[model samples]
Target: MSSLTMMPMSLEEIAQAVQGRLVAGTAAANTPVATSAFTDSRQIVEGSVFIAIAGERVDGHDYVPHVGAQGAVAAIVDHEIADADVPQIVVEDTVLALGLLAKHNIERRRALGTPFTVVGITGSVGKTTTKDLMKALLSHMGSTVAPVGSFNNEIGLPLTSLKVNAETRFLVAEMGANHVGEIANLTSLVPPDIAVVLKVGVAHLGEFGSAERIAQAKSEIIHGLVPGGLSVLNANDEHVAAMSAFAPGDVMWFGLPNGDGGNPAITAQHVRCDELDHPSFTLKNGDGEHAEVTLGICGQHNVMNALAAASVAMRLGMSIDEVASALSDVTTISPHRMAVSTVNKQETSFTLIDDSFNANPDSMKAGLDGLLRWKAGSESQPFRIAVLGTMLELGPDEKDLHVGIGRYALEGGVDALLTVGSASDASLDALAGAMADGASLAGDASHVDWVHDIDEADRLVTRLAVEHPGAVVLLKGSHASGLSALAERWQALAAQ
Candidate 1:
């Protein structure tokens, strides 16, 4: 990882920025900060500032001594750290203080009078992928900073923003929220010059209560944009396209052609996926500029994500051809997002599509679509299996949503379906069973089964690998579903 480019500041100056009181090791108040702030004590570098956040399981204050020994110049704490070797900045809330410090860093970068663009992205789905694509596209122009994964929450967004400095040209700030006002709070730290709203779906419907409420929550990013900032929206999604009304400045649309004579400002024409499910299309702009884009990544769903990233890069002076070339160079994104690999078990190799980083109704169907698109190399008859986990936070219709996925998978040509859940959580297990039942209703009951946990699921998959030598398996679920861990286990086994 590159060293953080945050400008150096005295410990006392940091204290004033976060509105904290400087205590302990007062003589070191004049010391210059050598690194940016960090929340994890293990990541602390010399002269770094540590923010001590109190969580339910563990309090960050417990690691203060450890960070001090690691040469952290100071620790920001909710209360005093009396016996610490380094200076302590006491504040009322460490998390809030961390956000304040990030805000201060952004303000400092702006004060240098250097060129910088902060692109904020938020939506129910596609935030991380879009962020990754934007980072790759923008890096071709100048230095770019973005989160590692889906680090778009309050804490993650601030930690990512603290990496920016005077020389950094682009900051792709991904904003995510489980409830209202979360993105608004994140935008206050680093208000974006270009805000991208990908799509409005029910990823966290249980928290927000309705799709309309989710749309309202997603619109906060547009509302939080800097004065005269640009808003990039998805034209295919009605909810997101409606957000254009809330933009203070201009709005740019990106999507597949609707075939009704209306075209998004940025769109994919003649889009089609190959035998491996990799999409190829002609990237077209409203100005009549076009480029052929055969994405190195899999999934037809990614076309809109590519268009969204291309919109921001083109807005920042990157030509259409440059954007297409950079986008094609990206072969993968953060792990478990339509990530394809060939794993060998007992000398029989099977294809694995690990889209298990997270899941919802929309993403689950997309994964199934990808699975249906896969074509076996030489096998006259290939079995396609889908290992799906529970989709949480779909409001009161959660069960119905799970059932819909199961029915859709089976009706859409999935050969085998396995729904996984933990035995400890009967409710989740029941939801898993509901999916199997839906599949049974759509097809054969013997073709569907619900497993109690990953261990049982693994046993079943291993047996299937033996019975069917060349099967394509897809693992799709939320993080709590443990399917990603299963994917990792199989991947590790393949390596050995």
Candidate 2:
């Protein structure tokens, strides 16, 4: 919530530049721009533009009165709303207007001669992390702007485009998908000469309905790339591997241990992951160019994130040494997307792995992997745990996707499992059954640990901390479920 010394322009002036209209204003042409923007009415600030949008269940026109009170200088309505005189810049369609405005702004910015390098990234997993890596690597070389948080969706993507201007040298745009064609729409608004598609997984299965559909939805970014653009993909992910033929130009791949299924690119070795699995490794290309780089963040999965960013940077002419050196000063973002926070309600008694910021199958797996790494070689005797919440937005196939995470966590070495939320209830049962069956196979049936709620397990976690003295715990869930509250309470008990 910090303020920038940026000027504001009225909605009327923006309409004139874009060939839009002033529908109901006696002050149409007279209205000067206080600020330029493209968003629903709710985001309208003082002297700003309100893009009256229509989507899903609600129409933005329904909120024009509220926007006016919020100080929007003029309202841009597509179809007529029941308004008299708030100075409307009417358009054909507000959603399309949002993209066109963004597209237009990008063009104007480009004409300034120092067009920012637009690194467009989209996939099921690691888009945010990869975007963060790319942002860090680019900032090492020049001024960079990346989206703040999951600002990669419909509203977020257009909003991110507004941040691009004459001052921005690099803009790391993260694209996300839910249904088919979503990525394509966003990519067209800000085409990239260098596109990155990270790992694809069962992310929005609720919307896409199947993993194959999910993969197809993710592939939209490849097709939308600017001609002769480079495509950077995860060589390890089968979905990314399939995209080699679709890329318009050269395809560069990066992965762990360097798997060559007849195509060779770059590889990373001598990896040293911290308790969080944040990586510092030596990166060597098919050529002899080599350097040791460590991530500003941590995670076993983040190794790939760093590699993806490094690959794009190196191709764009950044030296390995510069990328490696700048990484040391970069920092990971928060809300337990593998963040280690100091905002403890308790003593610094336990580390909280908050994957609650966003969750899908792969992110859950990566978070669990980080937890295992943290628990490894620790002096804590009570063992590590996984607290899970429902991965919302996975429509009908939710049960199956939830089971996939449950199985991965059990196999990955989380000693105890704690599940919350109604969507994950079935996941809890399946995990208990899987653990029981595995225990039975080992000839021991009494050791499976499953808690019905976070409260029930809080005391046990406290005892684990007291007994072992240095217990590490993981708390992960979707943002909607407020799982961090449990993490805070658990940390409080451990502290006392």
Candidate 3:
């Protein structure tokens, strides 16, 4: 919030951008607007503009007087609030008004003729990690701003864009969708200079209905690029690579060599993991360019993420060595995605891989693979334990997907699999049990156990770790299953 300088917009420009008429207060059109915009009154600082949004559970209009008392200069509302003290701009829909304001702000920045650029990213997984990596790498070049967390939706996108100003050099936007046209709508707010499509997977199969629909949703990012902008894609994903033709500009691909006679623009070769699963590989760019790079994060899956970010950095005039050094400096920015921690209790000591932010078929397998590969090369041959929870939004074939993940664990050489979720929630409990059942079918039944709750799973994992010293345990699941909470519990106990 306090990094770069933010220019305030005039009230007249806000009215013209949203086509709203200021119907109240004695404020003149030339008056300076607020410092920032917000829909939640609790975030309203001095000189903030309150945009009233009526959501499913609460209405922002109800907080008008509260924010005004807290020093809000004006309010953008859909209806006239009785006896509202501050100036009010009435629009048809406040959400659309917010987008219009962001679009105008972007255009205004473009009109300044500065070296501002917008890079948009969209994918089923790895979007957040890639965004964090790009932000860290790009920061070494110029001023960069991105969303706080998973702020990739309609409301989140515009809020991030509102922070852009004259001195802003690069803006990294994360676009996400649950349906076909969601990304398209977000792209309209701020057209991108460089579009990155990570992968087209079934993360939201329930809402999208099919992987094909999900692919279409992901391609919207490419379609929304500005004229002659570049496209960075994952060559390993056929659905993603095929999107190149749809882009309005040239494309750059990143992935490991497929050995099908296709050389990606950026590639990682001779990939190796250390004792803690940190990957080191030779980075190869187009035109016989190569650099020996090492990553601080612990995941084979993240190698693809590194390639995507490095491709962007290279295209933006950064040398391969600089990109490698920047990437190597980053261990893990965002939490709960392959986040590694060492637990050194008196009774038990092991490493914990906390990937408990969210889960799907693709990410669950990726995390499990990382857990297996981490211990594969170690002399200790640590017992690799995967404590998995429910993967939500997998559609009607959820049972099959869970079973397949279980089989993946067994085939990937996981020594023990512990499944946990809500017991009272019959659907999730059954899903976790189904995962354990599938793993039991592949290996010894005693190695796979499904607990109906987190407490039992926590006790089981602690007991297992004490039983097998120096073991590596992984916690992977959606946020609802409380696997992240269990990880936090272990972290706090370790701190003590």
> Best lDDT goes to which candidate?
1
Two-way lDDT contest, 1 vs 2, winner: 1
Candidate 3: segments with Cα more than 4 A from true spot: 1-7, 28-30, 56-58, 83-85, 344-349, 494-496
Instruction: Give lDDT tens digits, candidate 1, residues 370-426.
Output: 999887344575688999999888889999888889999999998899999889999
- Which runs in model 1 stand beyond 4 Å of their true positions? 376-381
- By lDDT, rank the candidates, best first: 1, 3, 2
Question: RMSD in angstroms, candidate 1?
Answer: 1.4
RMSD of every prediction? 1.4, 4.2, 2.1
Model 3 CA lDDT for position 27: 50
TM-score, every prediction = 0.98, 0.83, 0.94
lDDT, candidate 3, equals 0.87
Predict model 1's lDDT versus the native: 0.89
Clash count of each predicted structure: 0, 13, 0
Please give the range of 10 consecutive residues that has the lowest summed lDDT in model 1: 26-35
